[model samples]
Target: MARASRVAALAIAVLFLCGCGTVANLETGYRQGWKNAVIYGGVRRDVQSAGQWIDHSWTWGKDLDIIQDIGTVVGVGLVGIDIPLSAVGDTLTLPVTVPIAIYNNSTNRASVSRKTDAAPPAAAVPVNEK
Candidate 1:
């Protein structure tokens, strides 16, 4: 009976240790995944904003206007811009600083710009070669 009890105790201890390790691993993976989602989502939003700015600038000209919307996601903050006016030559310029939470895996913050002169100089050149 004593031998059987000892074996049972050892088995219980081993099971407890294995369960603890599994929990730790699961927690670590969850944290990493959450961090990645925040960083990637921020980057994706920035890219979309840049594309929209380009298309709007092209269609609207210089009369572009943008309204910023700020919110948080899973403790990470995000900023969104809504451009209502898209008319070139209107001379609309605004400077905005947006707060974003970058994941621990990332070494730098995301930067987004909405401006009139983002196009390359080569693209602005006339079709007729000088």
Candidate 2:
């Protein structure tokens, strides 16, 4: 019974830790976080970057060799497993993330408007009255 309880606890711990997207998004602030969450946290981004890197690697080129293809498949499979976990996390955290995103948006817009107002107007072009 004690061993079974320990196993259950470990499983719960792993589930929480596997939510890489939620952690990454929350750390980077709302705007970027929101974007990351939308794009499957960092799953899509990581895969794309990895593919590009492999394509450019000396051992690999635009055409993936069998070994490289298998590696890519494995990497994608791991990321695929994380996708649903991240989606769940992102959904659960929406209440928090949404407010932060709104606040960041408003503040950025206010700052930009202030800067525009502070700048001097452009020189007016001379015109002849008919």
Candidate 3:
């Protein structure tokens, strides 16, 4: 009876450890995926806005390569489980939230600047100000 109890306890412990490992892996993957998506979205918005800054005759093909490279780097990092996460119950959450917030801010700023530049100068300003 003693030996049987010890074996059962060891099995339960191993199962618990395995469960924790699985949760950790899932959480890390999810966070990394989210980060990659946010970064890529920001990069795309920035590239599009940059396109408007250049003359109509100029192309943005070369500039787009940089965005693609950023995406690749993010992809590699995610697949490698480079992003860490904290366990909360059964779910894993990102340990760092700053990157996502910064990316969102950058995207918003780029989009706003692009729209402002695209609008006619007179339309962008109030008639009373002029």
For each candidate in the order shown, give its overall lDDT on alpha carbons. Answer: 0.34, 0.61, 0.45
lDDT of 3 by residue, 3-116 (tens): 999999986665454333234444454678643433223223333433443424243576676666555555444333322211221222233334555775788798888877
Q: In candidate 1, how many Å is residue 59 off?
A: 1.5
- Any idea what lDDT model 1 has? 0.34
What residue pairs are clashing in model 2?
Answer: none
Comparison by TM-score, 1 against 3, better one: 3
TM-score result, candidate 1: 0.19
Those runs of model 1 whose alpha carbons end farther than 4 Å from true positions after fitting are: 1-39, 60-130
Q: Which is the winner by lDDT between candidate 2 and candidate 3?
A: 2
Full candidate order by TM-score, most accurate first: 2, 3, 1
Flag clash pairs in model 1. Answer: 60-86, 60-87, 60-88, 61-87, 61-88, 62-87, 62-88, 62-89, 62-90, 63-87
Candidate 3, number of clashes? 0
Q: Ten-residue segment with the worst summed lDDT in candidate 2?
A: 35-44
> What's the TM-score of each model vs. the native?
0.19, 0.52, 0.22
Report lDDT (Cα) of residue 29, candidate 1: 39
Q: Per-residue lDDT for 1-130 in model 2, tens only?
A: 9999999998667558656656566656454544333334444444554466455443635565766766666556546665556666666667776776677678779888887746678789988899
